[model samples]
Target: MNLLLLKLTLIPTIVALVTLAIRKWGGKIGGLIGSMPWVAGAILLFFILEQGKAFGIQSIQGSMTGIMALITFCLSYAIFARKFTWLPTLLIAYVLYTLTAVVFDYLRLNLMLSYVLVLSYVVLTLYLFPSPTAPPADGRRLPFDIPIRMGVATLFVLIITGLAHVLGPNWSGILTPFPILTSVLAIFSHTLQGSNAAIVTLRGLVMGLLGFTTFLYLQAHWLPEFSVATSFGMAVVINAFINVVVGKIW
Candidate 1:
């Protein structure tokens, strides 16, 4: 791993471990180690954003890499968190690796009205799910959520970017991104933070992404052929997964 990822992954581990140890030992040890994750995550978050200008991130490739790092680093802690279970976390990681490979393509797209529309829908849909009760980095949302929201916004941008990149300029119609089946899992990830939701979201995203993408691939579909109706249909499938995966069908 590079220096940034090292910081992003290691610091959080150190902090969480130190904090927990202090409870058993003393506060001093906890104070030192516990400071690492938050401070590291914050600093690293800024650094990742900064890389955009360091080498002229105006390019899609850089932006895509940046987005990959943004989401990857944010979700890194989940690697150690109890939320992940089953074989699919590995699957999502692999698929995400594939998605990461396309970041450059994602970066190339123009941020047009279509971009705004997709993002608005993702955010709105995410809102419908809401976050589940859990310790919110000290029992409340804070500056911490800034990066989280920023990362998700980047995803919205990505979804839009991905959509526009796949479809051409003249062919405008309601088309979903990869697959709507995974959309609810994205929402569930936002709201719930437990072994159950964690397991479902992780596995569901993988299953859903695979299922939806496979179907799209079979259609021999490219960007221009995608329409808005297809997008909605995909989203419905994603929600169907959420229903089974999270018992949120109602």
Candidate 2:
């Protein structure tokens, strides 16, 4: 339990403080940290509050609710920072999920699948849907840094989660999706480095994804039908491989 809370809060909090002390901190750090554990703990607590227990691995319905709540709370914080825009976003997701949780007794499977389907939509939005209001990464040219950092973070979390899945069937069935990893990473990167486009962020994203793709292909079997040759081939396409070809083009 102590370890869980440390993983959940103290680490991020301390890292954030260190960045601040070192005069490296920039962008929306405070709001980022403020929203994290509060939101996650809220959703986890919500289930415990309503159901009297943690959402077990087998409870797809509960798991999905927690995921959706997380998604809603997360974006809501990052985007609005306590403003009008936040309310509509929160209300819509909350109302929709509320309907599912309350009025729709007949469509449990449908609700869970819908939330999972929304998962990709949210991620693609991370890449495709540019933020209306960005964190104040002042004087920083590396706008692409944070998102790439997020991609890297997601790759790491996915790799670890995949390992857990293989090692622990009982745990796998519980399916505690760390979908917010990318978001959290983006927030942290901005807080730490002042801009997400730090060369490190891009490098980390490309390397991490490539590493995970290899792990998935060689040992983990994440995409069962995807051949190893095909996987590495795509990784090569990220223009990162061009550095190998063009030699120091950046």
Candidate 3:
């Protein structure tokens, strides 16, 4: 298989499918599904395959930091969405996300500490996330919505992977959780459906971060001791299981 071709097509396909699912199931479930490690998972696999498993494992610590930044992005977006439109809300959230990422990268926390701190933060954020007053309104669908999403998301991965050499494993990992997908969903929802819809979607994305964090943490441990296939497969299952449990309770 051509790894490059897979890299180009896989994320868009996943994003397309996730978009369709969101349309079908509504914001929360769609956001949860979107929150899965679709982008980061693929990026890490490529790192392991091209760079080395050791590099991939080392990058997971950075990914933990990325996850924290992601949480801030979603939480801030939800908060700002209450008063502002998508553009301003996204800008504010992005600034906060970048600040969090930079500070955490400087701290250079270990995998275990990053993992614990991220999980603890996820719990606290979930408790604090805004609840939609009502379900999302069914606004008219945007033309080429899914295609645009797929393009933007695939572009982010391509640019990041293209620059992985320059950025190195730690920076690449730190960027793995950047809010491309989250922004797309939030902007569309905020524009078409309204602020509450975006809030619901972002909150659900944060909820999925619980499992997303676990997946990255597990890969750091398992990738060192197991084959890439076996390690990723186990992480996928565990991530799904964690999301399932969290979904049922939250």
Per-residue lDDT of 54-151 in model 3, one digit per residue for the tens? 88887888899999999999999999998998899989999999999999999988889888999999999999998888778887788898899899
What tens digits encode model 1's per-residue C-alpha lDDT throughout 31-109?
Answer: 2222221332232223324342221112222322322322332233235234544335534544554454355345554
CA deviation > 4 Å runs, candidate 2:
1-55, 59-61, 75-106, 110-115, 127-250
lDDT leaderboard ranking: 3, 2, 1
Candidate number that wins on lDDT, 1 or 3: 3
Error of 2 at 198 (Å): 19
Backbone clash count for every predicted candidate, in the order shown: 18, 4, 0
Q: Which prediction has the highest lDDT against the true structure?
A: 3
Among these predicted structures, which one has the highest TM-score? 3
Supply the TM-score for candidate 1. 0.28
Cα-based lDDT at residue 31, candidate 3: 86
How well does candidate 2 match the true structure, expressed as C-alpha RMSD?
12.6
Candidate scoring better on TM-score of 1 and 3: 3
Quick one: RMSD of model 3? 1.0
Please report, as a residue range, the 10-residue window in candidate 1 with the lowest summed lDDT.
170-179
Tally clashes: model 3. Answer: 0
How would you encode candidate 2's per-residue C-alpha lDDT over 105-194 as one tens digit per residue? 234445335444444434443354224343334443355544454344434433434354253422321223333443444344445443
- Give the Cα error of residue 214 in candidate 3, in Å: 0.7
TM-score of each: 0.28, 0.31, 0.97
